[model samples]
Target: MKIKQLGERALIQRIAGLLSGGSDIVVGAGDDDCAVLDTGGDDHLLVTTDMLHRKTDFPEQMTARQIGWMSVAVNLSDLASKGASPIGIVMAMGIPPDTEVEFIEEVVKGMDECASRYGTHIIGGDTDAHDELTIVGTALGKVKKGHLIRRSGARVGDLVCVTGHPGTAGAALFALDKKIPVSQDILKALFEPVPRIYEGMALAGTGSVTSMMDISDGLALSLHDMSMAGSVGFRIYESRLPVLPDVKRLLKKQELHEAAVFTGGDFELLFTVAPDKIEKARKACPLTVIGEAVEKGVFIERAGRVEELKARGYEHFRQQGQ
Candidate 1:
């Protein structure tokens, strides 16, 4: 069997279980991108690490600058989802000794772009020469006492809304996989992932949304994670899902709804709020009402039928063999 068959969570528990953590670690491994811990006083510190390799995370055709910039943007996307501001970044870069200095500079320049945009600084990290290129980043952010959004806050009868559309990134990936050169529109959506900094802040400022998370690992996985964490059920409307024209074409080609929701790496935000207060939230942020929270299990409304939802989003090193 292949690891992809096991889904994303099973794979996370499989590997994350092997690692150990310090006592002060409030949270480690699992759930919404990264783990969080209580920083001494009024702040909560978030730490997350993600890797980029040619075969797994990036394609060889991608430039050094695109690679480095995406690395920072993705992690910062995680931070933005939590409604936190970044403070520092530390990198663990693995490069072949033969790698050019000019290429490295491009990667750093990408990082710099995002860092300046979000007001975070890449403080320090380590380097190692490896057979393949690998870039890893661990970021630090401080969430104010009451503003940190977690997956566990969702409640039954809450309205499910998403920031931006759900399928652009997936559409972008599809284009890359088939070597389908993208149209100007698709290329921008796929390459430039906009972290929901403004949207998150607006949602956080409203003081109404019960729960929130970025749609990094696709909509299904993010929704599933929030449901499990909040111990509530979600009923997502398939027809109501905002899919880009490009993504719909991609889904039609695959003949699978899973292609739209199961594949990950789109860094939009998924969140829930009380149905009664949904109007207020709508006024506060630019989000689409995709679904709602339910009682027991995750459900999806497709065509006209409503059924339980069972699928995980993308992961590189989850399940290797069946």
Candidate 2:
């Protein structure tokens, strides 16, 4: 009866069933961060919001500025996956009354810097007092009618590809927990992640991307999501996984591989394209082809064998043991 027993995904399904979508709504909840809405124009409007709590999201090593940047970056990443041009961002903060004004100013500075980097600005928001620190950001963006990418367009035989690599953020988290030494690059990967905005837009312009989504939930879960949305399956080769060479050397083989598949926090784009259009897609955007879509269930091929892919990535309620 409670959320803990059902898990985040199940709870979302229940909530989605109760919600009614209007004709103006292009894409609603249950897929990505933003809900696409059509306003009888050549372009569709995208609305998305993301919230981060201090207890769960903020790391001890992160400063107020880093937290602020992350709060905005996460939402922008969602818009990027839709190949949308950001309109603006509105941020709401729930800060403790005792918090220093300087700290809050630094947070705003961080948000402004990150927004400027993406060619967007923070328009307005509300502030409130709370027992703990909470930051919420709502972003608005727009995508041309036919250019908007979704998670459901992937077809069988489509080539699955990803922008950049994975495992750096995951490995950083591991090192932080274990008190292991890590390079500045690794810390940067975890503290300040770069969203694939230009890459997503380029891929969308090529008209070759089928299903597209940000791999914030890890590669294995992201593939599962694409598979379910497209009503197809996927078979990714382990040898084809993209990971930084430094990470591979620092972590054990199994550890790095597991992080590549199971770690969340990476904001890279994972998308698919038709086999015939793979060359065009690659020309438009640099990405590594890791696999292809199949007819049925999701799988991964490794060491000359194949196995069913499991969703072992982050789950909110499950992770909290709620």
Candidate 3:
């Protein structure tokens, strides 16, 4: 069968099925955000990588600096979900031979600035000639063995929480597509997403969070992912969702809901906390309790009615209209 027919997630699962891990591997392929390795230290090693293409990942309006920032941000988001502190980053750039040297310099500068902002640095990387501008970033992180969080530890009756506002990035994309005027803040949400590094570490330290992952693939799809990982269900209330004023103002009710649930690029953390320990989680980070874990089936409550939450979001190797 064609790869497009299999879709991204299925293709990943197929490839993961062929892989095997050594005893040192704590979390292996297709399981969590990062590969956790027990390196015989006080902390576990975290590793994650993400690739961005000029045509599909980067918007035309983004500057070279923003592109660089985004490339690193995406990988860091994965580290954040694991409640790990970043150690360093390595990026590989695939660029056209005709690209300007100054543009590349600015890109590296952006990468450096983003890394430094999160208490890390870009140690080294490689560059090669390619038709399209492609950047692949690999980030290394560390978390204490007892403090590491995964997507598979959530339990029934746990409170579902999310950090920061959702849909802002999606709304920014919508605004850009329609050529609607929006503030730079809204646009920045898409161009330069801030990984919740501090919040993740704090939540992990609190010992209240049960499971966690970044919402890079939209809220609904993320819920589905966590559900499958933990073997638990989620029932989130629509009214409890934290909607950005800009998003609400920009789109109608239906579009607003769609942007909030189904659109991606937010890069916020979606996690579950023990209901009784929620105060500790709240003190650790600014989060909104929008729902709770259930026995089975992911559903969203809207207007006092419940419906199945479809696993739909930004996915690679799939047609937009599909």
lDDT by residue for model 2 (199-284), tens: 87888899999989888878888888777788999999989988888889878987887778887778889899999999989898
Clashing pairs in 2: none
**146, model 1: CA deviation in Å?**
1.1
Per-residue lDDT tens digits of candidate 1, residues 1-322? Answer: 6775666677888777888987766667875555888767987788777777766777565677778778888888888778778889988788899989898888888887877777888899889989988889888887876887877888778898887777776767767777876666655555666777667767777777888887777677777788778999888888877777766765564434655566666778888888888878888777788888888788887879987777467655465221
Cα distance off (Å), candidate 2, residue 89: 0.6
**What TM-score would every model get versus the actual structure?**
0.88, 0.97, 0.99
Q: Write the per-residue lDDT of candidate 3 for residues 1-322, one digit (tens) a residue.
A: 9998888888988898999879999999888899999999799999999999999999999998998899889999999999999999999999999999999998998899899999999999999999999999999999999999999889999999999999899899889999989889989999999999999999999999999999988999899999999999999999999988877899888888888898889999999999899999999989999999999999999999999999889888887534
**Residue pairs with backbone atoms closer than 3 Å in model 1 (clashes):** 1-322, 3-319, 215-268
Q: Which ten residues in a row have the lowest lDDT in candidate 3?
A: 313-322
> Model 1 Cα displacement at 9 (Å)?
3.1
Better of 1 and 2 by TM-score: 2
Pairs of residues clashing in candidate 3: none
Off by over 4 Å in 3: none
> Candidate 1: lDDT over CA atoms?
0.76
**Model 2, runs deviating above 4 Å:** 320-322
Worst 10 residues of 2 by lDDT: 313-322
